[model samples]
Target: MTDPNQSVLSKLPNNVIDEILIRLPFRDAVCTSILSKEWRKHWCRLPQLTLDSDFWKSKKDLTGDKRATSNFTMTIHNIITRHSGPLTKFTLCIQYWEIYPPIDNLLYFLSRNRIQHLVLKLPRQFKLPPSFFTCLHLRHLFLQNCLLLPPPDFKGFDRLIRLELHEVTISSKLLESLISNCLLLEQLVLRISDTLSDIIEINAPMLKSCDFTGDMTTICLKCVPRLTELSLRYYRKDWKEFDVANFLTSNFFESCPDHLEHLHLDYGVIAKGQEIPKKLPFDLLCVKHLCMCIYLDRDEILCPLSLIRSFPFLQYLEIQMEHNFKKNMPALECLEMEAFPDVIFEHLREVTLIEANASIREMQLIKLLLAMSPALVKMVISPHRFLGKSTIVKTLTKLAEFECAPKAEIFLKLV
Candidate 1:
C-alpha cells in the first residue's frame, strides 16, 4: 500500500511516519485529525480503515443506546466520505443492526475506489449487497454471520488468494462456483452450518491447506493435488454402520499431494479385530507426520495402528486418546503384534502417546514400538494424571526386557 497523498507529507519523502500512524488502532489514528488542520488532511487520505466495536465502546455510557449508535454511524459515515484515494484494506466487525443501509452505501463507495482486502462480521445473517462482490481486485476476504447472495453475473474473485467463511449461509453450488474461479487460491477455511445438506465438492487445483469443521465423510476432494495440510474438527461417535472401506476408498485422501505432511482428525474408524484389506482407497506413502484422535475401547490399539501402517515414510506420529468407551473395560494382559506382522515403522523417528494410562494394553504398544522402529529417537508418554513413582519403575523394568532395535530415549510426563 502506497501513501495516500504524496505532496501532503513529502517533507522527508519517506513512508516511516505514514505507516506508524495507519498501523495504530483506528480510533487512535482518527484522533490525530483533532491535532491540526494539516493532520486532518493527512487522515482524510488514509488508504486503509479498520473499525470494530471497541472504537465506540470507549464512551462509558449507553453503549448500545439509540443515540450512541446514531453518533457512531454518523461518525463512520463522515470518516469514510471525507477519506480520499483507493482503500487497500477495509475491515468492519461492528455488530450494529442500524448499520445495514450505511454498510451497503459504504461498500458501494469503497468498491469504486478499489478495496482489496475486506472483512465483515455482522450481528446477524445480513444479505451482502451486490456492490460487495463487485470488488474484483480483492486478494483476501473474510466473512462471518452473513448471507452470501452472489450477483447473477458474478464471476468469482479471480485474484483472491485466501478465503474464510465462518457460519455464513451460502448455497453449496455457489461455494463451489466461487472456489473454482479463484485460480490463485491457496488456503480455504470453512465453518459451515450442519443445515447445509448438499455434499460439498472441492476442485481447486491450486489449494494447499484447508481447515474444516464438519462431518469428515461429507466433503469430497477432486483434483486438489497440491493440498499438503488438512485439519478437521470432528466429534466422533460409535459409528456402527461406518465402514472402514468408506475412508480407505474415499478420494479425500487419494487426491492429496504426493508429499502430504500433516493430517489431524478425530474419528475412531476401526474396531478391536477389524480385517485389514489388501489394497487401500488412498495412498499415504508420502505422509511424514500424522496425528489421530481415537477412542480407546477394550484396549483396542488397531484403531490407530491401521492408519499408521499407510504412512511408510512417517517420521513423527502422535496419538491423542479419549476414554469415550467403557471406562471399566479391562486391558489385555500383554501386547501382541501377530495381527500386524507385516507392518513396520522403518523411518519413524518420534512418537507421542497422549492421555495414556499405563495399562497392559498401552504398555504393550510401547514395548512393540521399542522393538520395531529402528530409527526411533524420542518417545514421550504423557499420562492423563499422576501415578505413583513405583508404577513408572515397574513399567520401565518391563520395557527393559523387550529386545529393541533403536536406542531411543524415553520421557514420562505426568500431565
Candidate 2:
C-alpha cells in the first residue's frame, strides 16, 4: 500500500514535477530519487541539467568521503543514458580535462536531444569537437578556455541570440564569419586572451550591445545599425609613439551608429604628445553617457578633451584617471592654450571624476568642466584611496573657489 503523502505527491502534474526538479541543483535533483519511485522518473525527465563544480562538491560533502567520489565521466554517461526527456539547456563547468577523452560523443548525444542553451568552461583549452556544430538549434552559448575550429562546411548558428567567449581562441576569419552568419544575434561579450593581430569585423546588424576587453589590431563596425551600447578595454602591448593618440584604433568609431547612447573605454596612453587633432571628423550627437580612462602620466589629457568636445549633447560623464608622479609636468598650466578651445556643453548635466588627487591636471580638468557645462547639474569627486585628509582639505578649499553653473552642486566623497 502506498503512503498517503506519497500518493498526493505522485499525483502532482508531470510538468509540475519536472519544473521543480530542473530548478533544483543537479545533486539535489538526483537525490530526489529517494522521495519515491515516481520522483525518480521526474528527475530523469528534467529539461535543464547543470553539472558544475558545485555539484561535485556537494556529493563529496554528502558522502563525507572525498576519496571515493564517483568518476565524473561515468556519472555523466549514466545520467544521459537513463534520461527519458529531451534536454534544452546544459552546462558543464569542470576541472581536470586532461584525464578525459574528447567530449564529441557527449556533445553528439546532446545535439540529438535538442539542446538549445550550452555553457562549457573547462580546465584547459581544447578545440571544440565537430559535434559542437551539430547542435544547430542553440540560442545562447558561452565558452571559456577553448578553441573554436568549426568544420569547413559549417554554416552558422542561425537561431543564436547571445554569444560570450572568454579566453577562447579563434582565427580572425572564423570570428568574423561566425558572427556575421548569426543573423539574429543581439548581444556579444568577448574577454579574449589571445593577442588578435588581425582586424575583427563585426557585421551583426541586429546586435544591440557589445563589451570587448582585449588587445586587437583593430576592429570595424561593418553593419551594426542597431548597436546602442559599446564598451572596450584594451591596452596595446607596445605603447611606442604613434601618429594618433588612440594607437590608430580610433577609426573603429568612424561607423558609430547614429543611435548609440552609451560608450565606455579604458584604453590608456591615448596620446604621446600634445599634437592631437583639434577636432575629429564626426560627432557622437546621440551619445548621452561617456565613460573613459585618461592618463595624466603621459600627458594623454588633450586627446580625451578633444574627443569630449565632439560629444556636443552628452549628459553624463565619468572619468577614471591614471596619474603618476612626474616632476617634469608643469604644476599650474592653464588648459586655455591655443590647442584647447572652449565650448559650452549644451546638454551636459552630471560628471564623476574618479581617482582625484589635487594634481594640477585633475584640478584644471575639474575647473574646465565647471566653466564649460552651463547646464550642469551635479559633480562628484572621489579621491584616490591613499589620498591624505590634509590633501583632501586643501583640494576642497580650492574647489570652493571654482566658477560653476548656479544650479550645479559639487560633492566630495571619500571612501
- Which residue ranges in model 1 land beyond 4 Å of their true spot? 1-14, 34-46, 56-68, 95-102, 235-245, 268-282, 297-301, 323-329, 332-335, 352-368, 380-407, 411-415
The global Cα lDDT (0 to 1) of model 2 is: 0.80
The alpha-carbon lDDT assigned to residue 197 of candidate 2 equals 65
lDDT of 1: 0.72
Clashing pairs in 2: 245-270
- Model 2: per-residue Cα lDDT over 326-415, one tens digit each: 545674353653345556787999999999877877787898889889899999999999889998999999999999999999999889
- lDDT of all predictions, in order shown? 0.72, 0.80
Q: Best by TM-score, which number? A: 2
Lowest lDDT sum, 10 consecutive residues, model 2, at 61-70
Residue 191 displacement (Å), model 1: 1.5
